[model samples]
Target: MRKNRNLIVLNIIVILGALVMVFPFLWAFITSISPGAGLSSTPQLIPDNPSLSAYVQLFDRLPFGKIVLNSLGLAVLTTGFQLITSSLAAYVFSRMPFRGRNVVFAVYLATMMLPMQVLVVPLFVEMKTLGLIDSYLGVLLPSIASAFGVFLLRQAMNSVPTELDQAATLDGAGHFRIFGLIVLPLVRPALATLTVFSFLNSWNSFLWPLIILRTPEMKTLPVALAGLQGQFTTQWDVVMAGSVISILPMLALYIFTQKYIIQGVAGTGLK
Candidate 1:
């Protein structure tokens, strides 16, 4: 009877926590469908009259399709480049033998500690020097290589048995051949995790794109969403609608790769 009581209490607690977490998304969805709704001190959980007018008006008010395409293009390129660069760098760190390798990797790892704010000015200057300002390449330049991605993938690679690489080497297999045909297939969960992370970071990026992109046509989703807010008056409903639309792609990706995320995270520490 005591155990049953404890289980009931635990279940109730979990249910309450879940509700608290889901409330904001529920409110956003409700607000998106309630046209002309302003943010309230006490937000209404349910709308009296729900309408899709805000969603319609969202596309009408802005060139959101262009913005979305820009974001998608940038994100896809950034994620792809990160995966390739990070995997190569990680393989070197994990498998290659050289002088000062640990020191070099340590320096690389230290970079992840530095916030993006510190690099913005120098990156902007470099972009300006290359005449890449106001271009997608300018926005993409910094994200192509990721320290966190390298660290994650290196840790994953370390968990793989060195015997496999040794056997491949004895068989006259090159590093590229072994990496492509052997190691990569084994660490798929880690790659999936990195893919999700890289995509999310690029998709939700606001500051860099805002600083680099000057034209309306080049604006990404977050920047375009920011435009929905007025200096003195804001449209809560349309903004909420935009929020919903922006999250759909990410949500879908996560749903499909959810299993890998857990496995990757848990396995990364095993090395």
Candidate 2:
């Protein structure tokens, strides 16, 4: 009886904790669809009368679609670039024997712990010199090569059995062909997780874009969302609508790739 009671209490505590964590998202979601007026005084989470006016005004007041497209474009392009660069680097480090490979890999992984903010000013000056400011390439450049991705893929690649690579090589396969045909297929789960994470990070990046993009046309989702705030009183409902718009894609991507994400982590080091 004591154990049963203790379990019940613990479950209740966990449920309450989850609700506490989820409360902000629930509020943001509810408030987005709510009309702007009387939002502050609403005694309940769900509006007395739900409306889509906030979402309507969000796009009508700004180029919401353009910002969404820009964000999506950057996310997709950056993810692709990182996947290729990191995977190749990881494969080389894990499989190919070369001089000073451990030393180089150690240096590379150490660099990942360094914050990108330290590099932003120099990156900005370089972009300006190259006339890349306010351009998509400028937004995508700093994120193209990722050390986190490299570390992750290196660990994943190392787990892949050496037998597969040897068999491929025996059949007259080159390194590139072997990677493309055998190693990549074996690490599909890791690639899917990496792709989803890289895409979300790119989509949500705000500070760099705000500093790099001067024109309204070049602004991505988070920057454009920040623009919803002004010198005067902010539009709470519209801001919330924009917030939902930005987060929904990430949620959808996570949902779709959740299996791969968990499986990738679970499968690590079994070989």
lDDT of 1: 0.93
Which model scores highest in lDDT?
1
Q: Report lDDT (Cα) of residue 136, candidate 1.
A: 94
Residue-pair clashes, model 2: 0
For model 2, what is the error of residue 165's alpha carbon versus the real structure, in angstroms, after optimal superposition?
Answer: 1.2
Clashing residue pairs found in predicted model 2: none
Query: What are the TM-scores, per candidate, against the unseen true structure?
Result: 0.95, 0.91
Encode model 1's per-residue lDDT on 4-36: one tens digit a residue: 999999999999999999888888888899878
Local distance difference test, per candidate? Answer: 0.93, 0.86
How much is the lDDT of residue 205 in candidate 1? 98
Candidate 2: misplaced stretches above 4 Å? 1-14, 37-43, 269-271
Assess candidate 2 and give its lDDT.
0.86
Q: For residues 1-271, what per-residue lDDT tens digits would candidate 2 score against the true structure?
A: 9999999999999999999998877788788777764346553575777888999998898888988999999999999999999999989999899999999989988987778788889999999999999888898998998888887788888889999889989999999998999899988888988899799889889888988999987789988888888787787888888888888888899999999988777766422
